[model samples]
Target: MSESSQSRPVKVTVTGAAGNIAYSLLWRIASGDVFGKDVPVELALLEIPAATRAAEGVAMELGDSAFPLLCGITVTDSADTAFDGANAAFLVGAKPRGKGMERADLLAENGRIFGPQGKAIGEHAASDIKVVVVGNPANTNALIAAHHAQDVPAERFTALMRLDHNRALSQLAQKLDCQVGDLSRVAVWGNHSATQFPDLTFAEVAGSPVDVDQSWYTDEFIPRVAKRGAEIIDVRGSSSAASAASAAVDHMRDWVQGSDGWATAAVVSDGSYGVDEGLIAGFPTIARDGRYEIVQGLELSDFQRQRIEASVAELRAEREAVGDLLG
Candidate 1:
């Protein structure tokens, strides 16, 4: 906890340090892009035992970068070691869905990975640790992690829905010929999968409410944003890594620094927007003072409601599939 002129150097743990997404993420974090330029960080990078050598290689690269805000680095294969005293964690490790694999199989595999990590986090992480799951099946993985981490407040666990949020922003920007930054209040609701609803029902472009054709919103915009991952894979022959990493940074940055306005994140629902209680569902959120609250009083149109319900239903099925892991 060494203090710089700005703030104490906080310990941040990142799982799956050797993976593509984490490879993109670590340099950004070490350079203080996720935190602030003045706020230093001690990175605890975790990989599986087989990837320990690769993790060390990453540490070597970080050393070469010589980032001013990077106070220290620890590379390990053990969750307990990685999470010990961690002020923040990115649960980026999970079994990816392979070719011909069913959704149920993917959920079960990730459950095995996240369950123990969650328990370790509950026992070893800092009292105020904030966690975000960047792994596949993220929303339900987050739900599993939060369920196991009883010692940590459930509100601290979130899944990355910022990717979907950003995708919606970009698609809208492309359609309207506006800068992505010019749009605000773009909400991504429900799961991170194809079922996610990128609700522009309340969005504004350049300080004016956007009124667009309903057909375009439904037929083109929503599907494009929802399936952006597949589109990336089709173009690149790989899953999204850099964009996912960037979105994770955005999610955590706004979370730690306070989003000036609305952002979308998958947080454990307090029954907001009729989402089932205890489910980690994406919703319009505000991050302030190092905590997130689901934005209240946004009236959902019937279309939005039905879309969110479909996504939540998928989440519910995922939960039931991993029911044994919840304990």
Candidate 2:
């Protein structure tokens, strides 16, 4: 749309296009909110066969919205078709935990979904394709996908921890009686689950070190951020949609463009802070040249170390449960 357009349209494939999160995310991306106005994007909407028709309806709405940078749209039930030539992908479709379902059951169900999709991405997507897993059990789902997508660099596969990162920021902002923009360097470590640790050890507000009460940080702030999704579902009668979509956009945008400061993402660990190597765990990260690098060498207090270790153990157990699926 702009005269100074620098490159061809990025082909982005989004699974679960018929769902609420995708519903919110598609509009943001199509409107050039993620990739900027000067860059164009073509969307490949992937849905299950039962949901393909709904995905088509969503495409029709996109057409009606008249997004200037949306060059194309394709709705498909096939993962191979969806990932074809894709430069970016958001794996948002996974089996949700139904009544009476155990955690292992959820992991195996999602592994079945992501493994095939990952293989499809490996065979079909562009060489530089980057992927984000937005579905529940996201960290392990990403690990499964990365294992199957052997051709794609494992580091390119990340889970959506930015949502937790943002939750931590918002909670801390409220506690400090300051705007969210006034905060910097807040990092979420470990799984994007109840075990997550939203560390403010190095956080700053208005260029000053954060000095919140220790009991508040331990008793209120950490659990609040870690379990925010469950809290949202409890209060709203449904899981988060728009906020999750926004965080996905934030994570992908930072990965594609760059981060202004430290952002939290669930990237494959290189054993930083004693997280298991290859575990997709949340860490303080910076993006540059379209790659996320974990911010290393930060001192961890004993409490923080224990919090992180507990989450990593959960991640290890998950990997074991899906051992049959991984290569």
Candidate 3:
């Protein structure tokens, strides 16, 4: 067998290459530790034409890292060319709401971006390409992207929820004054929106309910995790970009490297949770063999069900808003 064929190098494409997530994501992917020591990675960066120069600067820094397992780097404005031969893709770019912009406008703008990018990936990305969307309005944007990428597996597109999941776990731990390692199976449900339900009933500390008799829930817990995103925005005067970026790295890392914990993510539905079959919705999941299977049959309390349904409503609304644009 040929030595190069034996190695099976992975090519990772980062769309929105000049964005904050890509800045953090590229360095980690190049370090070879992203997929562990044995797997080598080639980075392909896709940036819009207006952002290409800044992306080049990011690529220059990647060159300086000198990571041993980084096989190559390719940067381009063409999504088709950038995604070509890619085994994994991080869809992290989208139009940010300028001052006074509406949600419909944001969805419309992102539809324009993800639709073509999705088509490009479908046309040129390797057959095994696994895509994760990190941009805002992620769930529907992933749906839009997935719809256009007909050749790619529908299961291949997913949106980021690891951040919300991690945030929920950390807040619960801190409120209970317990270590984060003690928490397991925490679920972040519905859209990656203000209404997302962070269900802790099934989460365990020593295989027991995380509430420990409801002390944490009634106290400073739920609000802390729910408001964490706004907290960052309040303190920073800008929405989270670093912690968000860090979450992107963690999502791709665990997806490629393998992990034991159930990582929650917004994946396109196949009628899970009664969410519309094509709308991407967040659920508790475990990633195995580079795929995520939502943990099923969780017992949902009335309160939790209401919260998740609210978020699902938001996602469904986004789908409707972007419906005409999808074509």
Candidate 4:
């Protein structure tokens, strides 16, 4: 009934010890982001040996904070050990886009890492374990990990869609001149890549339909959110790490903590909207009972359907590319 009861001691595992996002996320989890005031929790941090000290730095911070609900912390290089008994595992480490590498090359590099981690999770993680991929090329990387984790249900795996979902919420708020909390029903469709589509057709800004122009949709809004990652990279000289971390926390918080009145789009296994069964696809979703179910039977306008399909096409192409690489 409570967060700890629903998952228990909530053995949370975070990959990438030296990474910026994981650093941001670890302390917050230790401080009891989801477990509430009375619940207890333990943390298992996974890092490469090179970054174990940094992880320890974070562990030291946790101890210094002296959060009452924080029971214990463990840092390790072994995925098997880090994931053991973990109720939730966050895959946050991945190779980023280098100067000369293509997208396929990046996906291939991540596949090599996530595949074994997936198997480790399947073999050792707790029975109700849930995974979220926060690294780049998240959707396909999640597929790779899920495919390798043969023992786990495909639906148990998910990639972070909170960034896009938040972008849409923010945009709707701007359009309607209202607060983000009042906006609901926004959806992001298809891949998490540059091709993913944000659908505002059913979303309400301040409880009213968002009136946006198609020209602005094509010229301004869609491109803005889709390319926001790149813009962040240009300005910050690093890929989006902080906001990505925040989105990851928001995602797990919403998933384990419950959204109540709010629902956001998340990329889960495609069981809704006619997407192929195993591919990671985005849809309007709410997290409850340790699982996310895609909101079904929403009315779609002609324009929205076309845009969603376009994004799905891109996802299918990536799937094919990865499948070939696996072969």
lDDT of 1 by residue, 20-127 (tens): 999999999988888888888999999999999999999999999999999899999998999999999999999999889999999998888998899999999999
Candidate 4's C-alpha runs over 4 A off are: 2-8, 324-327
Clashing pairs in 4: none
lDDT of 2 at 86: 95
Model 1: lDDT of residue 129: 94
TM-score of each: 0.97, 0.98, 0.93, 0.93
> Local error of candidate 3 at 59, Å?
0.9
Clash pairs detected, candidate 1: none
Q: CA lDDT, every prediction?
A: 0.92, 0.94, 0.83, 0.80
Model 4: worst 10 consecutive residues (lDDT sum): 261-270
Please name the candidate that would achieve the greatest lDDT relative to the true structure.
2
Order by TM-score, highest first = 2, 1, 3, 4
For model 4, residues 245-318, the per-residue Cα lDDT tens digits are 77888888777767765455445555566677777877778777766778877777777778878877877777
TM-score of 1: 0.97
lDDT winner, 2 or 3: 2
Model 3 lDDT tens row, 209-280: 765556657355566666787898898887787777778777777776667988788887888776788789
Model 1 lDDT at residue 148: 83
